[model samples]
Target: MKLYPIKSGNFKLDGGAMFGVVPKSLWQKTNPADTNNMIDIAARCLLIEDGNKLILIDTGMGNKQSDKFFGYYYLWGNDSIDKSLEQYGFHRDDITDVFMTHLHFDHCGGSIQWNKNRTGYEPAFKNAHFWSNQDHWKWATQPNNREKASFLKENILPMEESGQLKFTDLPQTDMLKNSPLGFDIFFANGHTDKQMIPMIHYKGKTICFMADLLPTAGHLPLPFVMGYDTRPLLTLDEKEKFLKLAADNNYYLFLEHDAHNEIITVKQTDKGVRLNHVFTCNEIFN
Candidate 1:
């Protein structure tokens, strides 16, 4: 199996919102904010090539949203899914599966795009089967008030409408071994309802796709949960359990939202699981 890092795009978000309740004095040290108090965030998706199957995890926020809507996020950077795919001699059409960790706009927005005539929306990857769990599909489609803004209809419905949407089998336990996507899925609810974190086995190493469960290295601390989480207390428990497992197993965490740190390893520090080493995608994948 071969792996590639697909940088969908970059944008800025309020540091306070990203770190949630964590004092700026603490988080700013790892994720420094700019003059506007916004921190850089990357929509770093992962691509796995195994045999004839090319699966993409997350699509980043697509370019379909209006300028006014995007203005709020302060979008930046030239890196795009197309460019990144081309770097690996591939294209969106080559993708067989688009495994979404969740239906949050930034993660699956790029799954759908405006049609040629701009008359309506359509699946962006014509040949890919968009993947989401049944629980998350229901949660995102019928979003609560707090998460309504993040779950945009335009970014979601098209996949189902296109008849290319598929659901992974939910495991009875927190972790699902040997999923349909050819990897294990660890489910977490604190960030959102049934957020699926992919655990991929490649090159004799276990690479975990850290969606929002652990957005950045700075969030290694158990209490550093995102304000967007529906259940912060649950997040604390989930993060603690996962971090302990990550440290004990020596797993390589593939961070999706951190613009600065790509892949990180954690160690059991006195303070708890702390960042052990940082590696770029090239260092680990290439």
Candidate 2:
């Protein structure tokens, strides 16, 4: 199996919102903010090439939104989903599966794109089966007031409309019974309802897709939960447990939002599980 880091792009978000109760003095040290207190974050996606299947995890924010909508996030950087796929000698049509961690715009927006006429939306990965769980699918489709903005219809409805949407029958257990991608899935409800974190076993190493569970190495601390999380207390418990498991097993966490760090290892310190080392994805994959 081969893994490729598909960088969709970078965007700025309010630092305070990213790091909930954490003070600016603490988070700013690592993710320094701009003049408006917005921190630059990477919408890093992962591509898995195993045998006949090429599965993509997350798509990042697509370029379909209006200028007025994008004015708020300030998307930047030259890296795009198409460009990153080309870098690996592939195209959107080459993808076989799109495993969405959640339905947030930044994660699933690139899954759908404007058609040729720019009149309607179409699946970005024409050949890929968009994978999401039943619980998450329902939560995103019928979003609550707090999370309604993140779950955009343009990014989601097209999948089902195109007859390419499928849901894995994931149980409510902490550990997945059977993953659609043949990887173990860990579910967390802190960030959003039933956010699936894929844990792949390859080359005697475990690589975990740290969705919003650990957005960055700076979020290693249990208290550094994002303000966007609906259940902050649940997040704290999930992070604490997951960190211990990662530290004890010496797993490599593949960060989705950390612009600088692609993968990180954790160690159980006196305080708690803290970042032990950071490395690029190639360094770990190779």
Candidate 3:
């Protein structure tokens, strides 16, 4: 199996929102903010190539929105999904599965695109089966007031309308496991309802896809949780359990939202699970 980091692009978000109640003095040291107090965020998705199956973990926010709509995020950089795929000698059509961690626009927005005539939306990955769990599907479709803005209909509804949507067949019990893509999935409900985190076993090491569960190495501190979490207190408990296990097992956490850090190993420090070493995929996987 081969893994590639598909960098769609970078955007700026309010540092305060990203780090929640954490003081600027603390988080700004690791994730320095610009003059506008916006921090750089990378929509770093993962691509898995095993035999004939090419699975994508997430699609960064697509380019279908209006210029004014995109202006809100203050997007930067030229890196795009097609360019990233081409870098690895692959194409969007080659993807057999699009595994969404959640339905947030930044994660799943690239799942759909405007049709040729601009009449309606269509699945961006024509040949890929979009993976989302039943609980998340309902949560996103029938979104609460707080998360409605992130659940854009254009980014979601087209997958089901195109008949390419597939829900994971795992029970709703606490922390279920499933390996539909040959990688075990660890489910968490704190960030959103039933968000799946992939635990991949390859080359005698375990690499976990850190989708919002741990956005960046800076977020390792137990108190540093995102304000967007539906259940902030529950998120603290989830992070505590996961960080302990991650540190003990010496697992590599593949960061999704961090612009600089890609993969990191954590160690149990006096303060708790702290960043140990960072790696580019080429240095470690290649």
TM-score of each: 0.99, 0.98, 0.98
Instruction: Candidate 2: list runs displaced more than 4 Å.
Output: none
Q: Clash totals for all models, in order?
A: 0, 0, 0
Task: Give the better candidate number (1 or 3) by lDDT.
Answer: 1
lDDT of 3 by residue, 143-227 (tens): 9999999999999999999999998867555555646778888778888988888888878898899899999888999999888
Tens digits of lDDT, candidate 1, 1-286: 9999999999999999998999999999999999999999999999999999999999999999899989999999899999999999998999999999999999999999999999999999999999999999999999999999999999989999999999999989899999998999999999999999999998888999999999999899988988889999999999999989999998999999999999999999989899999999989887
Between candidates 2 and 3, which one is better according to TM-score?
2
lDDT (Cα atoms) of all candidates against the true structure: 0.95, 0.94, 0.90
lDDT of 2 by residue, 204-230 (tens): 999999989999888988899899999
Ranking by TM-score: 1, 2, 3
- Residue 141's lDDT within candidate 3 is 97
* Deviation in Å, model 3, residue 24 alpha carbon: 0.7
- Candidates 1 and 2, the one with greater TM-score: 1
